[model samples]
Target: MKYVVGLLLALACLQAQATEEQTVVLISIDGFRHDYIELHGAPNIAKIAEQGVRSEGLIPVYPSKTFPNHISIVTGQYPSNHGIVDNNFYDTERKQRYKMGDGVKDSTWLTTLPIWNLAEFQGVKAATFFWPESEARINGRTPSYYFNYSTPAPNRQRIDQIVEWLKLPEAARPRLVTGYFSIVDTMGHRFGPESHQVAKAVKHVDELIGELWQRIHDETEVPVNLILVSDHGMSQITAKDMIDVKELNIDEELFEIVNASTRLMIYPKEDVSADQIQQLEQRLKQKQGNFVIESEQQLAQLGVTDGPRKPAIVLGTTAPATFTTRPEEQRKDGGTHGFHSSRDMDGLFVAAGPAIQQGTQINRFSNIHIYPFMAKLLELELMTEIDGDAEVLTPIIR
Candidate 1:
């Protein structure tokens, strides 16, 4: 009997050890364009690509904005399905407005579960240094280790925390970890994408990533799989290209406008009639400058579903232009995104580790597919239907 009990305990220890063998570390470098690696020179990231898998580009969802794309990458759902149509939008049903940093605590706005939430639900622990809505409790589940979003936190500190989490005991350690850096995006927005400042920011981030990579490779007992990505790219836009809706001479009471840099969402007032809305659309068409009115069919093609959050009309621009309400005030000359998916809006994707194939390059794919790919790495089953299909990225997995 004593021998049999000892054998059972040994088997249990083996199972635990097997489970601790794999770890997935997801990192997001906000606004790291697809060409940034070659243009800005990131030797560490380039080395990772050379060692593992790299993509030509990672296609962002329509209106390639930060919050929406980041959420899409983790949730595997488009903005239309996830309920965060843009960084800032008005929900007519709730009579509430959502602004980037302010609305993250409210989980009611989200319709799908992020990969972190899914991991915890499936008995695998997860940790997040920072990610959009990572601090929120979605469906009553939050990552085991997470910090409230704060720009004041140092990038190196965040990386150090992730290393600490990986060093915990097997039972307490999180198998899934996520980290985010905003310096690249911030530089791109303040200085133009082509400016020297942006290149310097990229270099700074690449060095930090290198430090993290070295520490993980040297210190951790568990093998780590690193996946790096970005929300979207940046494009230069000047104040001269700004289009003010007030120039249309429409009644302000007829609709509420949400200006999203390259796009504008117009939601008609409650009392506005269908004919009045048609008239407004006609006026916008007549006075169209650098923007074009998006029809219902066009919206659908872009994965924008009909809902209270969906605007009555969308004004989009293909050029380096922005929609604004204050035309009198000249806007700053810098970089911006939220444009329709184009070469300028393409982001980055890189994966390296035990579970990834070395020296593999794949074609451009949508960011929505990343969630399922990460889910596959963590060996977690998705609880609900998601737009992402793991099959798209299965070829890169070992």
Candidate 2:
């Protein structure tokens, strides 16, 4: 009888230990600049930084676009390695184009495993609330719980769902959760990053985050770690700074060109002769205005090595100027991103919870490092090769 009693007590202690295991919730605030917390007055985010860890800045991967940087953060690989080279690109192998906001169902484009997929594979249940590509069944698996990417979903509801998931029975709960909010990015693009609209959006998102932080602390016994990040920052630009591609006088039929606002990707037609391509490149170099043409070597430096999606020639602007295909596409006064090596492209990073050291400040680091850090926090094995070095962030871990 005494042995039976002892066994029951031991089992109860083990169950308690299981319930107390750390939970990590990664939140992405699209286009949340590193300075927004201070410049826009996000008291809640500031509070998190004070109580936990903050970075001088989070350096986004090259081109610094939304989809690529977000994938980089979770996959710990560059866009070239992960195969999401840009938000929109032509996949020559697939003979199809990838468009942003298209609800891509095919997982063939993703060459690397994201952290959520990794967690689910290793018996650690994961959940997501509108993370990019989270809806897709990658590797024949999806997060245990997830919502399709919907711009109209209320932020409050997303927070409520996260809380509910955390409150689930230990065996059923997700150890990792991802949430995304895009109001800041939208407002930044419509009205410049420094505009009143962006400030208001920042305040609104901060309030939601405050509510999330409070609920996690008060509603559950599980130790929850909250990590906040952004894909990239924004830069103000005007129509007067637009570079019209038509002005270059290139024959449109000879090449496939994608004008990505901040950069222009030029892919020569298969039948176009090498001499013709060289002549076109020469013409672009001579006519290049505020933008600079990027060479193969330069592209490789940006982690855009040779690939089918890799453009034959890239024209990258120096900011305050962007490439535009049509006159109507130019904005009078708004914001844009995707500039390589621009400080304005730096994003935000703030983390607070049981696994992170309190009141810590680290220098700028690339977003790729985040994947390994989160994997460590979740106590998952690093099962794949990645560009991020876990040691870069090990010092901030408690």
* Best by the lDDT measure: 1
Look at candidate 1 and tell me the lDDT of residue 147: 94
lDDT of 1: 0.89
Backbone clashes per model, in order? 0, 0
Model 1 is weakest, by summed lDDT over 10 consecutive residues, at 13-22
lDDT tens readout by residue for model 1, 211-322: 9999998888887999999999999988788887667666768787887878888888788899998988887898776889888888888898889999888889875788
Off by over 4 Å in 1: 1-21, 327-329
**Residue lDDT tens for model 2, 90-198:** 7655657787744357787888889999999899999999888888787788899998888899989999999999999999999999999999999999998999999
**Model 1 TM-score relative to the real fold:** 0.93
Alpha carbon lDDT at 227, candidate 1: 95
Each model's lDDT comes to 0.89, 0.88
